[model samples]
Target: MRPAPAVVAMGVAGCGKSAVGEALAAVLGAAFVEGDRLHPPENVARMARGEPLTDALREGWLDAIGQRIAVSVASGQGVVAACSALKRSYRERLRGFCKDIVFLYLEIDPATAKQRVGSRPGHFMPASLVDSQFATLEAPAADERALTLDATRPVGDIVASAVSLLGEANS
Candidate 1:
């Protein structure tokens, strides 16, 4: 059977979760699920309007992503997903679906995050909400099966590190 690891590239809006997740998926020969694309239209509109999402608003989204992960894992195909899993509870919710799920936390400073978010065009999330994202972030605890990478690093380096970590984790 093929490896069936499930990994989430998690962090705040501008933390390169999408880019790193895509690259990591390519390296792992896995499917890449864009979490933002899975968000409800109402959530997108609210974020576009500079409103932060409440926990209640995010529950369904998290469940949707978890479902995707669960399906992929059950098929014995590895999967990598990008999500702004800024809270421990959010990560835990995902873990509820797949016990072996791993998280790749892209750590970034607020200034860089704000600058990056501001530069992205056509994104629903606004730079104005970057502060809210930071406030919501609860870094993974030491016990969690997670890898922390510097968001400032090049995508290639970050992906390489993740590949190494995943190798060790699966071995």
Candidate 2:
């Protein structure tokens, strides 16, 4: 029998990773992990002050999240996760822990990302850092276990579409 699906909803801040990840988890009947909350308090404080985190700063956090995903899947507790996963190396690191991992990249232009982040009430990521987020992002390539969707879609629509693809893959 096939193991359950483990998904990561990935993008820059304000691209709806949390909302969509939660919705997809609901649809898939999987556990939801909020990657933003998994960030260390110092990382949160630094970003809240409008600082962009360096790769070195994000390594441990990424590893921790990857471990959670692996444990969940190993236990047959499938999950949907939200993580920025901005760079290719970061995605690859997560993949190293779970080769069957699937990434759903929510692609957004810088202007929209900045606009959304600016309006967000209490998020640690400031609009000022959206540019750096874009600079770091590497959209999933064709060969990867991933899908890219427009980030501007309605939450329901995005979740429904993702369910179709994931359900198909699982079948």
Candidate 3:
């Protein structure tokens, strides 16, 4: 049997990772995992206070997300995860769980990201961290199996494009 499919919808804060990931998962009939929910309380608290998370603080969170991906792969079920996998190393850590995992990069300008994040309410991540997110980001290189999309596009359009592309590859 074929291995389960996995897709990580990744970007800086305010890039609509959660919204896009959830919609893509629904279209593909896969489970959606909000990476933020896996963050340790301290991490969430720090972010809520408008502080950026250090790499040390994020290590455990990344491991937790990787563990969830491992479980889904073991269960032979697909999963779509929304994470600000801002660095190549972070994506590499997730790839340790499933080498074939696809990454959907929501490419957006800092202004747009800040605007989107600022408009959201009741969210832990603040607009103050937008610059930090972009600062840490390392876009996937040409060799990586990543899809880059303009995050300013509509959610439905993004998901539809993802479904069409991933369907051909995953099928």
Candidate 4:
């Protein structure tokens, strides 16, 4: 068996992070955590109003997610967390807390992402914010250990590819 990874499904909103993360967790038999649930009410409100969150507003939320990763690592459990870790700094924060973490970035085009976000209902993140997400996204090209998957692919393919990446990394 391959070693378990502390996995993070990262991308802009509407890239299916939560869905893919959940499926990946089930396949890996690891805990699935939706990073959005850790967001403070203020952050949610800011996004709801189509306002992009400043780094200051995001610090607490990032810390909360990092702490979750730390706890999961300390317990010797693999965790799959879905977060919009849009910047290198944010990813660094997560890595600081979990040493065995592997990031899977869902790469989706702006049009497709906008469509997905627009179609979804009851989500606090407005479609208008997606542009900001893309603008803020600093992809991890330097990090060769990170897996970049096409979010345009079928969900099954995405999950399978992620599993394969995790398998290879842990082997």
TM-scores, one per candidate: 0.97, 0.96, 0.96, 0.95
Task: Tell me which residue pairs clash in candidate 3.
Answer: none
Write the residue-wise lDDT of candidate 4 on 19-126 in tens digits: 999999999888888899999998899899999999888888878888887887677788899998888898888888886789899999999999999999899999
lDDT of 2 by residue, 1-171 (tens): 788788999999889999999999988889998998889999999998989999999999999889889988999988898999988899999988788989999998889889999999977788999998988888888888888889999989999989888877667
Minimum summed lDDT over a 10-residue window in model 1 is located at 1-10
Go through the candidates in order and give the clash count of each: 0, 0, 0, 0
lDDT of 3 by residue, 77-169 (tens): 899999888889899988988898899999999999999999999988899999999989999888887889889999999888888888776
TM-score of 3: 0.96
Positional deviation of residue 157's Cα in model 4 after best superposition, in angstroms: 1.0
Worst 10 residues of 3 by lDDT: 162-171
Judging by TM-score, tell me the better candidate of 2 and 4.
Answer: 2
lDDT of 1 by residue, 24-115 (tens): 99988899999999999999999999999999999999999999999999988899999988999999999999989899999999999999
In model 3, the runs with Cα more than 4 Å from the true position are none
lDDT of 2: 0.90
lDDT of each: 0.94, 0.90, 0.90, 0.88
- Give the winner by lDDT: 1
TM-score-better candidate, 1 vs 2: 1
